[model samples]
Target: MNLNLRHAIIQNVASNTKEELEDTIIDAIRSQEEKMLPGLGVLFEVIWQNANEDEKEEMLSNLKDGLQKQ
Candidate 1:
């Protein structure tokens, strides 16, 4: 069986509205469950893929700050 988690995750949320997507992200973060990590990673992958250079730089900067705080 070939199970592509990233593809599955993306397909699952493909029809989500902006607010639904926001809720999904927020809920996943607040859940703190290991299983949710893959879904979050998939979402981040989509965001990173579509982000412009400036957005990517901002994301990296935010990521750096987040790591520092942790």
Candidate 2:
């Protein structure tokens, strides 16, 4: 088993449109299943990698707020 999960995840979503991607993310979150975490993590990694400083700061702020609510 030589699976590259990150690459696999990326590949799986590579052809999705914005709406489709949004649906996938939303469904994954709503499902509340542990298996979806890795896919969400990979999506977050992609978002973080592509985001600018301000976006990153916003994401961090949102994350902090989300954590506080938990």
C-alpha local distance difference test of each model: 0.93, 0.94
Which candidate comes out best when scored by lDDT?
A: 2
Query: Could you tell me the lDDT of residue 56 within candidate 1?
Result: 100
- TM-scores of all predicted structures: 0.92, 0.92
Residue pairs that clash (backbone atoms under 3 angstroms), model 2: none
Position 47, candidate 1: lDDT: 99
lDDT of 2 at 44: 95
lDDT of 1 by residue, 1-70 (tens): 1249878999999999999999999999999998999899889989999999999999999999999999
